[model samples]
Target: MPQIKSLDELRNLRQQVERDISTRRHTGTTIIVGMGTCGIAAGARDTMHAILEELRKREIDANVTTVGCIGMCAKEPLVDVEQAGQPRVTYGNVTPDMVPRMIEEHLVKGQVVEEWVVGRLQSS
Candidate 1:
């Protein structure tokens, strides 16, 4: 952890930790972005930024994480959305432009973006 030089910094760190814990506790929803070399080359960083921005703009709470290669080079910049009791859906060839609709439809409306989905895994 970084050194906390002031009380305000401590408070900010506490709030961030609390939010992380809360998000972890609510494992129902998670957004995973691929960050491997191929993914990064395909603009995963921008997609991730867009996802975060959209979530914040919509006041949505979700656990966003990153993963290494999943062996789908053709489908670089893959994004996965996992919700409680629902299949984990992976959207391939994701771009920053798609984040807003994906967030609105998947997170806010509780509907998957079927057309973008390339894979699905049931929770064990």
Candidate 2:
């Protein structure tokens, strides 16, 4: 870490921090679905479609992406939600039917559905 010498440096640091926060918070929500072989066998594609449909229906702007298995085979069909500055929440064994409420509660309302949360990645 670099030393802070003057108040101007401190102010500049604060501004940089604020810009980072705003960039993170305003970049929009991202939903990542695990699409590995196990996830596919467990119906992750349906879950992804359901999530996309819900977002379209609600007119919520978000990015829906896919990733390979995170080594949680038994917990196939895993879904990870990252809402701006919030921590990323991972849900296991997710079904298409659960997408709507996940969207409403987590993406739209900024509340994690604790019942379905299997893991949480804290923001740095």
Candidate 3:
């Protein structure tokens, strides 16, 4: 954290924090990528980069995160999408080429790509 040198700076910092909090509250879409050893070996890093690029190109506000192994070694390069009021959907064998269509159908059109889905978990 940087030192707040002036009142205006403090006010600006507060406003920035408030905006970040508001964004988190409103944008309920979260994209979780598996970055475990098996996942990386299966090209998860490329998938993650593709995801971020697609999100940026579409100007979508999403919370992209990562996780370790989920015990599904066969299903490496797993990507999970969780949105408000919807079940978390996990897609297996995700590659960079599939990112655009996934984001388009899932995030933009509000439809899950059922064909690529490997798991689904309903939120409580």
Candidate 4:
């Protein structure tokens, strides 16, 4: 690590750390998968893996993350997408098979895959 020589340097380091945390906190497009025990049993791991693979293949820049149960235990494998200035769309019972289309249409084309959506949370 480099030694901090001035207050400006400290400020710069702080800004960089904030940016890094923000990137991990959320991206322009965020893909959040439920990874709780129920979600895992419902194949959420496979769903998450598929989403990551598709993002890489398509060259999409988005934050992919996992969260605890979404309160809908029956909808264990739920996936949520939150894009800038858009409502967060939650999809229930997600499967690895639906990942590609979800990414292509929703993430790439800015369209919601209404067929898979269980609910939407409007942006605040």
Residue pairs in steric clash, candidate 4? none
The TM-scores of all predictions, comma-separated, are: 0.84, 0.78, 0.84, 0.78
Candidate 1 structure quality by residue, lDDT tens digits, 1-124: 9775777777888887886685567565889999999999999999999999988888877879999999997998999998888889999999999999898899888888899999999987
lDDT of 4 by residue, 1-124 (tens): 9875877777889887786776655557889999999999999999999999999998877888999986897986999999878999999999999999999899888889898899999999
What is the lDDT of every predicted structure here? 0.90, 0.90, 0.92, 0.90
Which is the winner by lDDT between candidate 2 and candidate 3? 3
Model 2 residue 11 lDDT? 84
As a whole number from 0 to 100, the lDDT of residue 68 in candidate 3 is: 99
Candidate 3 worst ten-residue window by lDDT: 19-28
**Model 4, TM vs. native:** 0.78
Clash pairs of candidate 2? none
Q: 31-52 in candidate 2: lDDT tens per residue?
A: 9999999999999999999999
Q: Which portions of model 1 show Cα errors greater than 4 Å?
A: 1-24
User: What is the lDDT, from 0 to 100, of the residue 17 in candidate 2?
Assistant: 72
Model 1 TM: 0.84
